[model samples]
Target: MRKKTTIEILLFSLIICMVLSAVEGSVPILPLDQVKAGMKGKGRSVFQGNRIEEFDVEIIGVLKNVEPKKSIILARLKGGILEEAGVISGMSGSPVYVDGKLIGAVAYSLGTFVKEPIAGITPIGEMMSISEKRKKGPVFSPQVPVKKHLTLDELFMLNKDFFLSKAVFHSEGRALKPLSIPLVFSGFSSYAFEQSRSFFSNLGFNP
Candidate 1:
């Protein structure tokens, strides 16, 4: 009886390990070092409401050292509404996969009024590193006291580091900024809405 129970325990542990391994194998990561120019992939995002859609992606090349110890994968996206919309807002953080291996997320695009669907991908490794750091501790700990009511100027001063930090990349004389997301407001008077819109616009939001 003892031997039978021990065998059952070992079998259960083995099954759990096998299940975990299979799950991990399903989504394999394509390291940045292996990515190259002209490689093709597919990106997934929600172009419309709730439903996820896929678009074709072709690697333009890699921009090495775009930031300190960081890199960005330059790719041209096609298909779906990408041709008509040209990398729509809120499409950032969309996953791109190459050869069934996860590569990166769509994060940056050329400024408004451009035609092509060119985008910059933030690599999976760097994203994972940031995620791990987040699990360890808070990424941003403000020095300001949270219990106190603050004016708009005081609030801005307290979080100025976060608000002022914008990562801009240049390509062919065009600046690449994070995709602009539309801001919708409700339950506000016209004057209040206008003031709020102007405030967000100054902070680089589409309002």
Candidate 2:
């Protein structure tokens, strides 16, 4: 949800208050792990949109609406504390672990206004899918493969470089084909990408 809206900010404040108030005298739970669907857990969050401190909450459900988007988690206030800390802004990516297992991350914040403490969460598996991709940067081959042994203008998808996992290496290579004789035009030319063909035509080039 867009964070610029005023209503969204207010909704976050309410949830933060709910969680913080519910956990009174109770330790605020914020553990880290891989979150999955249907995992029950809790979190502590502070809502900055309004005056509120860390609050606690219980997760109900995990949802996936679109790929690459944060997961949605369904939850409600436990009916204890102030009822503000249940869910709040800046709580996205909050870790949800159940039975010592990570189930997901916090995703829901105030988008459209609501009455009670309610929010969605992102699954920990999806979060891992993202975190796992961060490491060692992109893999680059030191040496170019021999010509005739490679294909022209081929595309390759970069694989994840896991830091904690054991190293796994594959002996694979790619071929780079020439897009022009001077090679200078290729540097800034449309052929640099798939849409270049159309871009060049827009530049008055015939096919």
Query: Highest lDDT: which candidate?
Result: 1
Alpha-carbon RMSD, candidate 1: 14.1
Q: What are the per-residue Cα lDDT tens digits for candidate 1 across 11-94?
A: 333533442232234578999999999999999998889999999999998888877867888999999888877877778668
Instruction: Quote each prediction's TM-score.
Output: 0.68, 0.38
Off by over 4 Å in 1: 1-26, 138-145, 150-165, 183-207
* Total backbone clashes of candidate 1, pairs 3 or more residues apart or in separate chains: 0
Q: List the residue pairs that clash in candidate 1.
A: none
Q: What is the total number of backbone clashes in candidate 2?
A: 32
Model 2, 41-143: lDDT tens digits are: 4554444445434334565444444234433445553443326443334454445445655454455443333334565554544445444344233432324
For residue 143, model 2's alpha carbon misses the true position, in angstroms, by 17
